[model samples]
Target: MVNFLQRFLVFLNIYSIFADGYSFNNDEHTENIHPFIKIGSKYYFINELLKMNWFESYNYCRSYGGELASVESHEELLALQNYILARKIESRFWFDGNDLAEEGKFVSHTTGRPLIFNKWSQNNPNNVNNEDCLEVNLYNKELLMNDINCNVENIAICKYREPNTHCSGKNSLMNQNEVCILRNLVESFAQVGHRCKSCSQAFMFPTS
Candidate 1:
C-alpha cells in the first residue's frame, strides 16, 4: 500500500507540472482555470474549504447535484486535488471520503485501500469528539477530519457529477428550499396589490 501511494504521488506530481501552465491575464483566461475533471463521465471538483461535517457533506453534495467523492485510489485523489490546484484557486478543499460507517477501518475513495493517505489534523480522528467528516487544508494540503453541527455555517466548494441545464434556473431544485419564503413573498405582493389605495381600504382584515 505504501509503495502504491509513493508511486501514485510521483505520477500525480508529474501530471501536475505538465498541466500547470495557464494564462489568466484577462477575464476569459481568468474563467478558464476550471478546477474540475470528467472521470467515468462524472464530473468531480476539489473541496475548496467546505467546513461542513459528515452528514452535511452528504446533504451539501446532494443540494449541489453531486454526492460526496467515493475515491478509490491515490491517483484519483491526486488527480482531483491537482485539478483544484491547477486552477490556482485556494490551497485546499474538501472531498466526500470517509469510513465512519465502520470506525477504525479507514478507507480511501482512491484505491479502496484500508489504510490510505490518512493525514488528519493534530489529535484528529480520535472520534472521541463529534468530528466525523474530513476537509483538505488549502495551505499545507493536509486533511482535517471533523464533526458536523447544524448551527455552524461553513461555505463548501460544491461539485456536480453531471451538469444540469436547470442549475441556473431560479425555479430549480436548488432554489426549492426557498419555496416557503417564495410563497410568503407572493403573499406579500398580493396584500400590497398592483395599484395600492389607502392602507385603510387596501387591507381591511377583520379584527378578531
Candidate 2:
C-alpha cells in the first residue's frame, strides 16, 4: 500500500512537470472571446475593455470554467500587479474576496475562507455606504485592495487553478482532494491486481 501510494505521488508530480506548457482546448467562447493568459503556474483572463458589476464578473468567470481570482500570496499578487502595470491597465478590477456574506470579515468567494493575503489601501474598507465587494485599485499606483460597492462596474479578473496532472477529458481538472481519493481507491485494488483501467490510462500506470 505504501509503495503504491508513493508511486501514485511520483506519477502525478512527473506528469505535472510535463503539463506546464500544455495548451488546454477550451470552449469556443473561451478560446476566441476571452482567452486565458498563463502567468507563472496559473492562468488568468482579464478583459480591460469590458467592465461588469461584482455579480456579473463572478458569473462571467464561472461560465469560463474559472473563478474570480483569489490573490492568496504576496508573490501571486506581485505577478498580477506586474502584468497589469506592463499592460498599463489603470482601472479597478474585481477579485474573489468580498465581505458580502458578513460585514468586516472578508472571505474569498472561490474558497469560502478568510482572505489569505490582502494589502488593503490605507484607511480603507471603511464600508462607506455599504461597500461589500473587494477590488484592486490599479488606478492608484500602489495597487492596493479596497472594499467597494458591489454595484460598481469594474474589470473582471478570472483565474484557473494550476493543472496538477496530465489527465485528459473530464478528469483533467480534478482537484487534489479528488486525486487523493482516487489514489486511495487505486491502492486498495492494487494488491488484487484489479486496478481501474481508466485510472491506469490517465496516470500511465502499468496495467499488468
Candidate 3:
C-alpha cells in the first residue's frame, strides 16, 4: 500500500518518463520505490545492486553509482523489476554480472571473475563461437546468456575501482595535483617579484 506522497511522486515520474519517449507496459507495481540511496549526486543500492547483463543499465547506474544488478535468483530479479516499475521507471536495465571472459566464469561488476554462485538460463551461453560479451536487450529484460564482442558500440557499465589501485609509477609522477601546486608557487613568486627591491650589489643589474 503506497502512501499518498509516494503515489503522487510515482505519478509525476511516470508522466515525465512517458514525455521522454519511454514506452513500458505498466506492471502491477506502478509505484515509485527505489532500492537505492542517493548521496550528493551518486546512487548506491540499498541492497547489493543487481548484476544483470546490459550495457545501458550498467551505464545508467554508473552515472549515478556502480554496476547493474547482481540478483541471485529469478525471484530477486522480479522483485527488483517490480520495485523499479512501482517507482514509475520505464525501460529495461542492465546488470553488472557477466561471464564474457571464460566459459562458466560469471563475475560481478564489483568483484571479478569466478563467481561463487552461478546462474544461467536453460541452454544459455551457447556463445555460438564468436560472442565474448553480454548485454540485456531492452525489449526483453533478461540476461543475454551469451558472450558478445567488447568493442561493439553500446552502453557500458562502469564501477569505481579502488582509488589509486590501477595507477602506475609513471602515472604517479605525472600527478596533476603536483603540477597544479607547482604552477601556483611559480605564479606567486612572479606576482611578488614586483614588490622586491633590487639587490644592493653594484652588479645586481646586468650591464647588458
Candidate 4:
C-alpha cells in the first residue's frame, strides 16, 4: 500500500510537466551560451577569468573551435582593446601574435597572416629572454604590445573559426524522426513521472 501511494505521487509529479510548456535541449543551450562578438569578418571570444600560459591558452581556444584572435587592421585591434577595457577585464592578456615559426617575423598560426600590421611598443619585439609570444597590456594610460615569454601566464582572447547566426537553434523546425522520438519520450515520461536534471559545466561568464 505504501509502494502504491509513492507510485501515485510520482505520477502526479510527472503530470505537472505537461502543465509547464518547455523542453530541455543540450544543443540549444550550447548554441545560445557563448559570448561571441562579431567584429568585421570574424567572431572573437575573450576570457579574462582562467588565465593560462600561452601554449595552454592556445589549446584552450582551439578546444572552443577557434584560435587566438588575429588582428588584420589597427581598427580591429583597437575595437578589441576597447571592448576589453569597457568591460573592466584584466589589464593584460595574451593574444595571437607569435613568431614561434620564424623568429623576428611574427605571424599568427591561427590566421596564417604575416605580422604586416604589427603594433609593437617602442623598442619592442625585443625577444628578451627568447620572448616569442605576444601579449597586449593596458597598464596605466599606455596601450602597448610586447613580445613575452610563452610560459608567462595571462588572460586570453579566443577567435571563433566560424559563427553561425542563422535561423537555427531550439526553436528551429525539428526533423520528422526527431519529432517522433521526442513525442514518444514525452508521452512515456508523462505516464511515469521520471524527473531528471543533467549536470553541466559551471563557470563564470567570459565577457559582459
Give TM-scores for every candidate, taking all chains together and pairing residue i with residue i.
Answer: 0.38, 0.67, 0.36, 0.58
If ranked by TM-score, best first, what sequence of candidates would result? 2, 4, 1, 3
Model 3: how far residue 10 lies from native, Å: 47
Per-residue alpha-carbon lDDT of candidate 4 for residues 1-208, written as tens digits (9 for 90 to 100) = 3343455567657645632333345344435546756654557887766889999989988888888766767887788767777787765788887888888988877756786576778898899999999998875644568999999999888877643333323443332234443555456655543332222212211222
Off by over 4 Å in 3: 1-60, 83-93, 116-119, 136-208
60 Cα displacement, candidate 3 (Å): 4.8
Report the poorest 10 consecutive residues by lDDT, candidate 1: 21-30
Mark the regions of model 1 whose C-alpha exceeds 4 Å error after superposition: 1-42, 45-54, 98-103, 106-124, 138-208
Residue 86 Cα positional deviation in candidate 3, in Å, after optimal superposition: 6.6
Candidate 3 weakest lDDT stretch, 10 residues:
24-33
Q: What are the RMSDs of all candidates, in order?
A: 22.0, 8.2, 19.3, 16.5
Residue 73 in candidate 2 has what lDDT? 81
Residue-pair clashes per candidate, as listed? Answer: 14, 0, 19, 0
**Per-residue lDDT of candidate 2, residues 1-208 (tens digit):** 3455667678667655544423343332234443787665467999889999999999999888788988768888888988888888888999898887889999988879999999998898899989999999764555789999999999998997543554333453333334444555455557434454335543554535
Candidates in order have lDDT scores of 0.48, 0.76, 0.45, 0.69
Give the winner by TM-score: 1 or 2: 2
lDDT of 2: 0.76
Error of 4 at 1 (Å): 85
